[model samples]
Target chain A: MLLVLAVGPSGPSSRSEGVLVRDNNRSHNVRVTDQVQSSKVPVTVLTGFLGSGKTTLLNRILNEEHGMRIAVIENEFGEIGIDDALVIDAQEEIFEMNNGCICCTVRGDLIRILGNLMSRRDRFDRIVIETTGLADPAPVAQTFFVDERVRDELDLDAIVTLVDARHIVWHLDDERPEEVENEAIEQLAFADRIVLNKTDLVSADELEHVVQRIRSINALAEILPATYADVDLVEILDVGAFDLGRVLETDPMFLEDLDHQHDQSVTSVGLEIAGEVDEGRLNRWMSWLLANQGVDIFRMKGILAMEGVSDRVVFQGVHMLLDVETDRPWGAGEERINRLVFIGRNLDREALREQFSSCLVEAV
Target chain B: MSGLHVARIACRAEPLAELGDRIASVAWASDGSALAAGSLSGQVVISDPTDGAVIELAAHELGALTVAWSPDRRLASGGQDGIVRIVDRTGEALAEHKGSGWCESLAWAPGGGGCLGAAVGAQVILWHDGGQLETHDAPSTVASVAWSVDGRRLGAAAYGGILWFERGRAAPVSAFEWKGSLLALSVSPSGKLVAVGTQEGSVRVHRLWTGDDLEMSGYTGRITELAWNSSGDVLSVGDADSVTSWTFRGRGPAGSRPDVLGGHGGRVLSLACAPSGRGAERIITGCADGRLRLYSGTDRSAPLAEIDVGAAVASLAWSPTGDSVAFGDAEGRLWLAEVAP
Candidate 1:
């Protein structure tokens, strides 16, 4: 049973002025604004525990006609047998394969694969990746933010997780739940939309309980119920989850609070960028962080206002794989500011903030 | 001094066939008659250096991560599947060496000897012809490996720094620690100096016997590759976006800061210095922007010639006679260009 839950606005906006106006949902409006006129290809990450239905959903998406060309990066646990099995349809743009999980071992493979996909820029309209069950989504997501080649060609849309409803309670209660729960919960914890599958066996009360539990873990993610892995195609793709405009309009405190409670074993800190950042100073600070606190820092990202560059330089890292790139120019009437977030375990936010702040070049 | 003298030389050549994959490792045959390239698709292709004709050797079950060519031109390649394979002259797998970790880099010892070295995960393995393999503890995850000119020592660059192990020794003779991770290392042809390139874009030169160090700075990206000239006076360093040459002043009393030779557009991935006694020797470089270029020692500000490879040039090597150059690209395409002086 394959399931896909894509959620976003239907059809192109009729607004001729190029800006969609909305009062109640500023977050959604912001996303639409950033996406306007920008043919940013949506990036969807398919994540699940081993055999939790990730590849099943991936196959379904490949077979369907979404009116856009899609590229699928199937990250297998070992050898990449999925690429040979994929029967290509002329309607789809391109289908690529990245065998092995997206971790330290295969990070270089990810960069090369993404670079190759971008070389044929006109062949695909969007990209979809099915991560190995044990793979961490943060590094994969950070790829889009870090590599200049990837950033120039692709825009991350959303991180989608397929939850095994039947095994959820049991998996979470294991003695060393951190092992299974870390990847699973991190998947859901960072999800823009989660597909809670295999729910037909559970009672309505039990399903509600599971939903509540997911909410307790991640308040930002939208939860959708799945029976035998059936989900709407329109509900899971192009969710505009990573739309920067939407990210800015939403209560900044959303990520701040979620960063704190997402994992008792992990924490995230957000820093404000008020001035130009010296590249040398930032390098020293990052070196110190990676050298001293790398074990605790699982992930870090920042939209920096550099000293010379007019656009915001975005940087992200997962463990040792750090990537930095220049993003879209600050639009007319947009404020030039910097914001960085660090996600990890037992990090001293004040110390990090102080170090990062000291890296700022003061106005002479 | 003000403009940082540089020039862009464009090559008029067609692009290599698209392998639809990323290139992982490349090597040039000792005779310079052929080039071998490997990609993430688990395909190895040997090609004619001039016309780019390919002979595919589909041996590995998984992606090949590194390749080395013996002095006699026998090919030894390591793959992500933890297998080291020796390919015959016909590019057929003749022997297999198995290990527990991913084999990342390979280096053939100088001379047509039976020994070959590989940086496999966190350890260095030396494989001899009699089926005996010796292992030495690498300081960190080994990213690159090189053999001393005499084959009596092996140098490996890893996470924290560079480690040199003398043959038959259980521990490293010396270890040099640095701030950032070491990305690549090259031992001088004369066996006098070891050049180490780090992730912070700094190139450090060490006097092999004395452990003295000289660090070069100013690059904003990671140093990707390094090569030492046969005379041991000049060093070629490639980084994420450019390539430069460094010349040492003297052996000891008059030792001075190394002079910089610069020319390259993208991050240089591979470099090779022409053999000694070749007047005004040329340094060949491969870059991310898909170019294979040559620069003369006399005029470091400009490239003598630039050939467009149409894929990221992953590795470069100079022929023994210095009459031709060999390079491999990301798509596992190899090219040999006949140089006219």
Candidate 2:
């Protein structure tokens, strides 16, 4: 069964007009705009836990006659090296990603490899990186933002993570090291789109439970159910999931029934508070919070009503870096409710809530 | 005085098969018969300047960070993919070494020692054309690696200090401790002084015997270049702007003010000291803004000649006789200049 769920582009206008390689010129045409996006290529990252149907989705995307030439970067664990044998042949191009973890030791390697690929823009239209199983997607996603050359030559589209419906609980329940939490949970927490694959393997009741569990962990990203990784091409391509303007897309009532209780330390913290938060205090609080405990907190997004400000302040963060921006302004007589959601490991909910509440301005 | 003088040379350009792939590093054969260039695109090529024939090979599919030529003319390259390859001039893979991370640096023992050393991940492996000869581990990723002229000792520089490994020893012979990240290393021809450029814009000269090390400051950014003049009494360094040479005569560069040489609009990207053990020592520097300058004298204060290769210089190398020099730029072009006495 191929279940296709439609997830709309979060913020189309926010997508930087990726400095497009015009044609067969093969020469870099520089544009004057945001220094990062002027001459960059679009890169999509697909990640998930082992047996999560990522390869299946990749194969499907490659096989489709979408008219777009895509380059696939496959990363397999070095010692085992099973990906080479499971290699899929497609009409498009495929290459190996850097060897070590993209975040730490092999960062330089990724810069070189990506810079090299950008130099040869005639071959591939877009780039998709399929990370190794049991890999954290944050580092892969961060590569574009961290490296000046990569950022200047690559636009990050989104991080799409596939979930194994039948064994989602089992993988998430696996114990993790102290500094490093469960990779399975991190995959889900970091995704812009969560594909609940292998749904047929579970009963209807089990599928419902899995969806609920996933929502409890990450209610911001769109959740789609699928079988054998079958999904529509439009749902995956050109989606501006990383746009900061529309990042805080949670519905006001989505967490109404969210009485989350489990044996795990990892979960989402959602808050809807009234009154405006002082802009200065909010910045200080966020800067301090992220600086101190950013590693423990995986992902966070919020829409805040700042004191004396007509526009809503949108904030999103991954690890230590936070992206803050002003989004659409408030309408006439609209209820200015602030909403925030944090997905992390072993979070002190009360401590965070109290600190957040301190930033609020009192109502007359 | 500007402490800078401008001159030009009759330099010739010989490009590779492809352009725009920035040359990452360059090296010359021990006998000056061949020149090997590694690019940011992972393509490595060995060229003959005499006849203009080029042998191109995909030495690394990603890119290579460093490359060197042994005494026997075999080229050893360390790449971004963490693979260290030793290949002949004809593109034959003589030997290959794999580390857990990117192979960031490579060096060959001077003289006929035939020792090749590479830094990959947190370990440094000293090998030849055959197999692993010796291995040493560091507390952090090694930024640079070098060997004594006689190939009797190996020095791997990392964050805390520079670890010295003796031949056939499983443990380090000694360590020159510094509290910063060492980005470049240059062991003098006499193997008496081990100079290091650090993450901070400074240079450190560590005397092997006395354990007395000196730190020279005043550069603006991280030091990317280090070299020793012919007599080993003068050490020249570049940290993006001006090139400086310190007097290493008596107490060995300790508490000595250095003589700053030349400056460029861009940072000094790479440095190559004269490789010929028998000639008058000179210093060559390549800058980020596409300028290459050569300086003469024990303090390297006299400017000899320079050329604007029209691209950011990525790497440079000197021939054995100090009569010729080869350099590669970020625009993927290689050039050779003849320095007439």
Candidate 3:
């Protein structure tokens, strides 16, 4: 496997403890691209259910000195509240850093903030992103891969999950646990390291049972027990982990590898394209998708090398709504490609991929 | 139906004289033959429809903000000085009614002889021939007022919501509350539907009798005005970005969203739909970007004709005979353009 090396800033000065495993060494044979130059900037995605100690953990992180210049991106569910007076240097809404980390509001505010962060590359050492309790990680993850500037300037690190151990069993047994579990499990599923916070409140057997549950969902992930999410900073950072690489390595059993499938409630499918598509065809396809598949598909995004266009066209749809915009051109020596990832339940992946591929402009 | 015939009328944009710096409000008569243009200088210009010749009438003190004409062709003009002046065809002030607050919106009852309604502060006042002004307390600051066809009820759209009142009732006949502040309201010709445009970019349509509401959402900006066609089947709503039309199909359920009619550039301040039997009656819209557009509800892909008015248009009205259209702008200039079917 050829590893594409990304040329940019030099790697961080600190040494990484983990051994770099070659692509062929893994059973999945995933091509691990060394294209991104790591700055050792740990972008910790603090995620949990609503009112699940995410902000509390954030407040603690801000108070303690970890030596690294941490830029926190706080994504509040409603209107943002005033932060404490101690963090006076923080930007009210979205701010960047001179050390390499960038912070911003969540969801819609992500794109603009990331775009701004990429413009000033030398500013941040690491980024810590916090998401609203209800946000799906797919869109945020896709952002790092979809934009060339983002992929070059920043490297996606570990996803840290904060679990309420006291309410875990009860939360899992509720009628709509699928709602809470979907976000929780997805965050955990993609995490390189899991911090089962608030463990002091749960019984010893219950804590062990929860750990087993987490392992059942993701066997590859390292589970770390913590009373208040207080773990050594070195464990969370410099993990040298990439889930996308793991996903590609799984090959034949890509989606079927996990023992627990995405909640019988929600599922996702990746649609690949071999050729450029017409603008009109895309519009018709989107209208048809909105009319027929809108109710079923909660989120959908497509990055296509559109016909007659030099730059890739990125389309994002929330429920029945769709917005399309042009992104940066394909990088030097990079292939002009078309790839769409759809996350929803009961979706006919084969049929959708076929329909999406048929929309491609036919060669004369 | 017959290949969608679209006709264009061209008018040379000429700056109006005598409208110097004191201009206020402008409107057109029902027949579209003449215009009732008022100014802050207490001057009114009654211009000919075919050629821009004026019949100037010096009517009041202080600037006029709104103008309306009764079905019988009596011109009613309201000013910021809290005075309502009723003028005849020759531009002579016939009746003058004095009020306490600024009179912003003026409308005549459809079939009633000479009855008129004006929104002054938080009260909606109905003025009759005997010089009596019937005042009704509005839920909030009254923004605009419109009278139903029968003249039996007057609908007032306030900063809060909708207030419907009958002639003799001390209390409101009925009221409807919406999520955002109300900007304008329009009642259907048959008195069946009342449409209210809100600042939150939504148009809420309520059946006059049942109090049922159907909301149509699409605009990301504020809705400025609303108008109903003569037949009352179609409705045209004006928002900050565009003007949309909706077909009220006999009112079924609550909270129904209507089909959107999209295409317009600036804030659409006013809209007027032609009466029935005019052969695909078009919707005329006045925009803040100073463009008067005519749109065919059948094919909303493009505008039939766009007239550059050179200033933000404040109001638009269609002729009773459907042969012409009248438009007013922020500069107190009124234009009457001949329409060919």
Root-mean-square deviation per candidate: 11.9, 10.8, 18.3
Worst 10 residues of 1 chain A by lDDT: A88-97
lDDT of 3 by residue, A1-364 (tens): 1112221112221112111111111111111233234553445565667655676677667656655455666544321213321111111222111111111111223433443333221345666677765666545654443333454557667667667777755554456533344566565554556777788888899999988776655444467777766766676665544422222221222332333344454455665557877666665666566667765564455567777777656554434434345556767786766666555555776678678777788832
User: Residue by residue across A166-239, what tens digits does model 2's lDDT show?
Assistant: 99988877877766668788888888788889988999999999988888777677888899988776777667
Model 3 segments more than 4 A misplaced: A1-364, B1-7, B12-18, B21-26, B39-43, B50-53, B59-62, B178-180, B250-263, B330-332
The local distance difference test score of model 3 is 0.59
Candidates' chain B TM-scores in the order shown: 0.85, 0.90, 0.85
TM-score of chain B of 2: 0.90
Per-candidate TM vs. native?
0.67, 0.72, 0.46
* Tens digits of per-residue lDDT for model 1, B1-341: 01122232322244333333556666678776777776655677776656657677754554677777888888888876668888876777777877655677888888866788888766888888666788887655677888878887788887657887765677888787664457678888778788786644466777777877877654544466777777777776665555656666454212333334455666677778876565437778888787777777677666677766677777666666776665657665545565543
Please tell me which predicted candidate would have the highest TM-score against the true structure.
2
Local accuracy of candidate 3 as per-residue lDDT tens digits, B1-341 = 01132356444355333443323455667666677766544566677766667777655543556777787788888764567788888877788877655576888877745778888756788887667778987655576888776787788886556888776678888777653457678888778878786644466777777887766654544465677777887777665466656666554223344434455676676777777776446777777677777776577657777777777666666766766776666565656665554
Local accuracy of candidate 1 as per-residue lDDT tens digits, A268-309: 566665778777676666666665675456555567777777
lDDT at residue B153 of model 2 (Cα atoms) = 77
Q: lDDT, candidate 3, residue A32?
A: 21
Q: lDDT winner among the candidates?
A: 2
Ranking by TM-score: 2, 1, 3
DockQ of each: 0.03, 0.05, 0.01
